[model samples]
Target chain A: MPYSETAREEQPRTPSLTIDALGKKCPIPIIWLAQRIGEVPLNAVVAVLADDPAAYTDVPAWCRLKSHPHVGTYELPEGGWSIHVRRNY
Target chain B: MLSAVEHSAVLHAAGVHERDGGAVSAVGVSRTGAVRVDAFAEAVAVPGTALACLQTANHEVGTLQPVAEVAAACREAGVPLLVDAAQTAGRLPLPEGWSVLTASAHKWGGPPGVGVLVVRKGTRFRSPLPEDEREGRRVPGFENVPAIVAAAAALRAGLAEEHEQERLSALVDRIRRTVPRVVPDVEVIGEDEDRAPHIVTFSCLYVAGEALLTELDKAGFAVSSGSSCTASTLRPSHVLEAMGVLTHGNIRVSLPRGASAADVDRFLEVLPGIVRRIRQEAGVSS
Candidate 1:
């Protein structure tokens, strides 16, 4: 409940799952990604749309901890980022 | 030492301990940013431990550690305890049972580069440098006589004006309670009570800490930040991270002696707008 609500976003990468944490805060964006990572199948690309400064680092750190491949992070036209992660089961 | 939130001084001291072939133990910190004193007692009780060090109070979050209890634990375990009272010296009473204590002069409104190191009677200590006649051979260099006298005067003056502390404490309390209500999506780092009177810290959600700091500075608020974006390390300060608190957009406000109530109120007034502006620039809706 502390985290902001999530929505889906369309990215050029066409991730299988998109977690929208656009206006959310630090650990919340990280929380959204961790909570919804299981929704997509293994090896699926999950895109996290976040603008939180902390999420820029936390997302990659979370991926490293979970052993998921952090594919890449791309800038968005609307001032945030789209981080693509490949969940490696 | 409590590694989770110690100032870098202790961290580097830990490095020295390792080089000296002594195993240094760290106590975990609670989410409120205080060290786990019970675990620290156990760590001190470990066999072959030579000395344990603890801070009089946490510098970042202003939370006071249970130094007396910890020092007692170290004593019972037969380990000498060093209390780093840099932040609380002259501001608060000294904690009991410390074998050695250290303080910084500038921290108490005195000239910089003057430090106070006191070893309690019967405490075994030797200068790492070659023995000298200066200060009972504990210090190697010639002491700065004027600076030391000025530092003592400043400390005495600070302790004399103890009533000013109540006013500063109130101001800090105002910041602690009002920051969240005024600025949307703000998380105050430490508790309202049981903290150093002069300090308060908070983090704004979705706002870059440096950006916030710049705006606040432009508005005449000279504050410090612990957020990773503000530092060259490119990582959040270990204190906030260890406590699992918001690490970005963090601001630490330390009121100087005789800080005004009107200034604090104005800070509360302008903070929301600053946070909003930063969030907007970041494309955050809130």
Candidate 2:
């Protein structure tokens, strides 16, 4: 099977959301998005962009507390980071 | 750390005069490694006659010794003042009218082993030892070229990130508020209005600093305890001692500009339990 077809067949179709919180420190990044994730459709993926070092530790911990699934984290060039979370009902 | 030349340039720019044959004084430094003061005070009996030296209260603690006042007193008494900017250099503004200033580069995010000392122009500073031909007859030995470049880069970077200081300050305030709410009887030191924004200190009533650090580390939190540095001796922090706060179970949390509020909050959430457990182990009540 092709890459897109394989991914589509493997995973459920969910809305994709991106939150740009670059340069925002700590709780603001997680807090802002956590508040907004409920507005997004259920089972949707929320991607958060942050530059703070503390976000790495905070985002995962926040996911644990809020019952969201922490999908993964990715590093960006030009000094930024991204955390992907899936909202569940 | 601002190097000797940079410090001297600042002094020269500020128009402070360094007197000849006077003691070298720095404000806000610990008694340990006070070679400049010791050298200046014992000049008459020792190898040379460089005069006055002074230091402020502990920098880690928010205790502001009367440095400027001491400088004024030294000026009236006819002595020179050298200030150590290790802990307070970037966070707090410098005290006015200091003839010489010194700092370490790594303390402010530059590379290590680079020390900065500034002497005012026309200040009579003679090298303690014989020197070759580097740093304009001031600092001897070959300088670490890359480290100096990195130090300048770090200084500029820190200055550019000045806006984040307020953010960190607010985060520190959150820690100050949240830590105590979570853990009762925990004394948070250096909450005075004059304290630096980047550092927060506290002591658990019934726990030891070492045990607290170990437990926190095991829980995946990196922090400094009074006993971390001097593990063998396990002596309490001199800063805490100077402030007359509880020294046994002290923890110093210094936040860099990159630390976030959520990280602080998570740490704060986990901290009370850690303290309680450590206290129980130490046979002290919460």
Candidate 3:
């Protein structure tokens, strides 16, 4: 639960909500993303930061499965990734 | 009863049977993909356990189960154990204390439609399905005699080339050792020492298994992958999941008898580039 609303300076895509789940395993980041997607306003970019290998492909897969638009993934300065998804109803 | 890492043939076979109030519990496997024999020992010692099943070696990862230990426990509890030796029928020696055994012919280059079933004397077995009232006999119906002969011949031939195990094990060890070194964000899975010789598995981070497999196939290497985004299954491989390893981007390489070291070397050479390309296409970097 390392989520935070950054001061719009951390990423290329400005995500209104960022769920930071660094160092977590597979499906946890996906689960957190699914659980919190409704919180953001419509068409807002919600970012989930996860390091598990499965999330690299599965986040896009979740979008394909749930019909959500995958905004794209961005590599962090350190390790892991910041996966972004647009909240589309 | 079954274990968490039994072959899907066993898992689905066990699953398809009609069960009414018959509780089935899957004994979990250790992190090394070996079945937790101590946990299994406790499960079988419980009274009223009908039958227990275990695979000879995992088909995905090459971890060999503690069949000898678990079989001793089953013997103590007076429960019958059925071993599915489809992966190791001709390749490895059968584990002792198995009351019954089953193997698929195609696994050892035999006819696809044939299977072998061996039920030891005095072991109680009643087919869950309604008995086919064709004939009163130990085995009924005309068997595929030609396919059966071919399967037997294949098994014998496969056994004769047992020396290949050493060469294959070396190659397997090579992959087990080299994959992680060559490919970044890769995890080589399964038991190193107590494993069957032919199989090796590894998972790559930030790559889809299907895309990697397709690219490998295009590069003229025949291999299998266990990933959720693939064709058939929508979930990651249960074996890798049970082992608690990286589930996606999984590749399982099974070296056939008389497999060439040069082919394996070529695979090792080409594999890193393929994984990198797949990662690039998936928009992932590791």
Candidate 4:
């Protein structure tokens, strides 16, 4: 209840799942991505939209620590980074 | 050294024990920002405890620590107590019963780079610096007399401005009362009863502290933020973390000496919209 939930209803064409972590801070974005990675099939991409400064480093670090392949990050129009990671586990 | 902000020097000093193969155990504060005396006792009771340090008040939240009670316990336990008065030197009366005391000049409207370290008589503190005759051989460098003079003058002037201090304190109270009401998802930190008058910290949800600071800076207002994201290291403030408050999107408003009520009003008028804009840009609806 402390974090604001703003799920993006738009469906991506790349068979990827988008998590609206736009307003969430550090650990929350990574936690959400980690917990919900199972929602997408194995090897599918999970994208996190986060504006928190810590996410710029933490997201990649989480992927590296968990041994997932980092798909790359794209700049979002709303002033945050859209980070993608493949569910290698 | 309960926090990394104002009392970083104390923390660094404690690190010396670890470097010498001794361990340093720190006791944290409760949600109200008050450290328990029993915890202090526990930390001191640890075998081979050399010294203990505590801040008189937290720089970020301005919550007063229960220092006197802890000091009494430390004395009975034969542990030297170092009191860091950085946030309380000029703002509040100095707490008694400290074996050693350290304070910064700039925190009390004095010249920067002038700091005070007092060792109570007969405390038997050995000087780490090489032997020198300056300042009774305690500090090795040449005394910065001019800065020390300016620092003393500033302290005198700040102490003499009691009337203006009261007026500005009222202005701070107004901001404390109005910010939460006008801005949603804000958690105002510190205890109202035992807080410094000039400082107020609050965290706004769904906003990046850096963006909010930039907006306020463009709007001709300058304030500090505790959000570690704004700092070079990108770590949250230890003070706010210890208080268990929101670490992101935190703002510290420290009213300058002789700050006027009109200035505070202008800041309050601009803050809500700036927070809203930042939240909106972050794609947060609330």
Candidate 5:
């Protein structure tokens, strides 16, 4: 168990932060993400949880415009999505 | 100057800038979102107050404004009052003393894409935009003649059905009464009487409004919600917020023309289970 734990800990993973934009409408999630992207360390992933449909496209588009890489999106079980964007800057 | 109960659209028209930190002196509203008359009187009485505008009735909760009183106040103050009657136009009679009245056709079952703007005679209004021939050069564009005809026809039909208004009002009453009783921890907004006939809004505790709305849609009923999660921006409704009501799991049931009693009954019947299931899913306690 110790060996397995050590091996698991050795594997590199992208650092991630969550911005709970759930229950917030469209531009809000984007705005919150924009405001807080600097809080995370460089190359870290920022996941914005939002339910607004506009954010599904807007977040990635914003990342593209801002020149950050959109990592991916994951659906939350309750509702909405956690849109992951990489802080390239 | 403006009323606290004014719609966002009106605020934009007035150029009451939200961005760049611009502000307008605004009148206040009662807990029920009714404009405070004394406060309105004060706001409009200020110097350089170009025009005073208000809605005949609020679109969200069906709360009717004191238009005649406000109109009288405006008249006494020599201020022009622009009444947005989009919600009240076909369903109710317009109160006298508005300098300008505006309405949308779609609100009254008319064709979408058609609107009416009436400037009372001797109002001394200048067109904000440059010259055009159509709409007396007030609105410059090629007229949508087909939509105009359809809108007029729909308005005529809507007005002819005065009895139908009362019927829909009764149906609305049923939902207003039944929703709170059926669903736990619900607050029905708007006055019991003295509200527009067709629209009823309510908020449910411990339920995510968008979830409830989606569940209802799956169950073959369509409704609107004011919950932040429900809106595209995920922002809670300004109307409900202004009314000082619960902002969560809010639902606005707008009974369309020709909707039956059974339809409302089905909605009331289905709503409780939907809320309960959602609460259970979200682990919200009773």
Candidate 6:
């Protein structure tokens, strides 16, 4: 088995997730956030951090399209943002 | 046009030392085709000085900088001016009051490695480094005689085509107007009233500049991004950063001489899909 597969199997299952998409531009942050959500168990909570100015629009749109429920969004003082998504499985 | 000896004599008469005081600073234009004056000012230490450095004759945004205004400023400050006419030297008449002008011959159909630097009478300049006995006191080293001859010939030929600039500028304007109509989520940069007439930049909302350039290259359109100078280090453009604009998925299109309307139309037709595909891959929507 690949090292990645072995590492995944050894890792403990968690209901909470974090996606650090800071410093990523545009669709990259949203796409990365979406992929991370896909890997979480049903009803899992995923938090995404993005620094792109467009993230205010992109993140919410992504949550809508992926059917993941948006928990909330908060603004970061350091010119970034945080979005919370709840995976619907 | 003075002969080689006359050119040397002119510099000598102007107190431009062949070895020491004949050097002029040069700066490279950004990928967006915009020239950054602050960088040049830093490099040459021209701040609050009488010395002026010229920007691209035609800016990357296709607008020409007010070289004459810069020259006037230098004059008011009692400083000489140097014009780096890389983008416009051979193609257009140089603005008045340019004391020293440098240009790459290849930009005007001449061979590479051949550069021309002209010093007007009474300009104070110095040679860059230690050197002796060469083409004038301004440039020291054995002359690439063949390249120089070719550059001169190319200059004359290019000057003959000055009339064509208006036509090409019009075509670029057309493309500038058409691109935004077709591509969504794009904000065209540098539409200032004083912008250049041959280059334009637009940033897609969700695409990365590198990915867009790669896709365009693969599709046979030679476009550029206003991002990093080299691959592997992905950073947004400093020009856009200065302007406080978004830098994602930026494309700078510089139309070469003789570029036709059909070519611009084709590029416009193909460009939106490229942006769309990249956005899709990145999972961004309009």
* Best TM-score among the predictions, by candidate number: 1
What does the lDDT come to for candidate 2?
Answer: 0.60
**Among all candidates shown, the one with the greatest lDDT:** 1
DockQ of each: 0.10, 0.01, 0.07, 0.06, 0.02, 0.09
Per-residue lDDT of candidate 2, residues A1-89 (tens digit): 01111122233333387888898754357656656787777777888888865455456545644567777666778777767778877
Residues B160-186, candidate 3, lDDT per residue (tens digit)?
Answer: 885878889999999999998999867
Which candidate, 1 or 3, would have the higher lDDT against the true structure? 1
Task: Give residue B141's error in model 3 in angstroms.
Answer: 2.6
When just chain B is superposed on the true chain B, each candidate scores a TM-score of 0.96, 0.77, 0.93, 0.94, 0.94, 0.78
TM-score of 6: 0.66
Q: How good is chain A of candidate 5, measured by TM-score?
A: 0.82
The TM-score that candidate 1 achieves is: 0.79
Local lDDT at B220 for model 1: 99
lDDT of 2 by residue, B49-143 (tens): 23444333244444444456545654554555667666666656778757777777886789998878889876667665577788877777888
Evaluated against the true chain A, what TM-score does chain A of model 2 have? 0.79
Worst 10 residues of 4 chain B by lDDT: B1-10
Indicate the worst ten consecutive residues by lDDT in candidate 1 chain B: B227-236
Better of 3 and 5 by lDDT: 3
lDDT of 1 by residue, A1-89 (tens): 00111112434467999999998866567656766788999989999999876676556655654678777777899998988888788
Model 5 regions lying over 4 Å from their true place: A1-89, B16-23, B227-230
Residue B282 displacement (Å), model 5: 1.3
Cα lDDT tens digits for candidate 4, B24-62? 777867665777678787777676777888889877787
Can you tell me the DockQ of model 5? Answer: 0.02
Single-chain TM-score of chain A, each candidate: 0.83, 0.79, 0.84, 0.82, 0.82, 0.75
TM-score of every candidate relative to the true structure: 0.79, 0.60, 0.76, 0.77, 0.74, 0.66
Error of 6 at B19 (Å): 22
Q: Which runs of model 2 end up more than 4 angstroms from their true locations?
A: A1-89, B1-57, B227-231
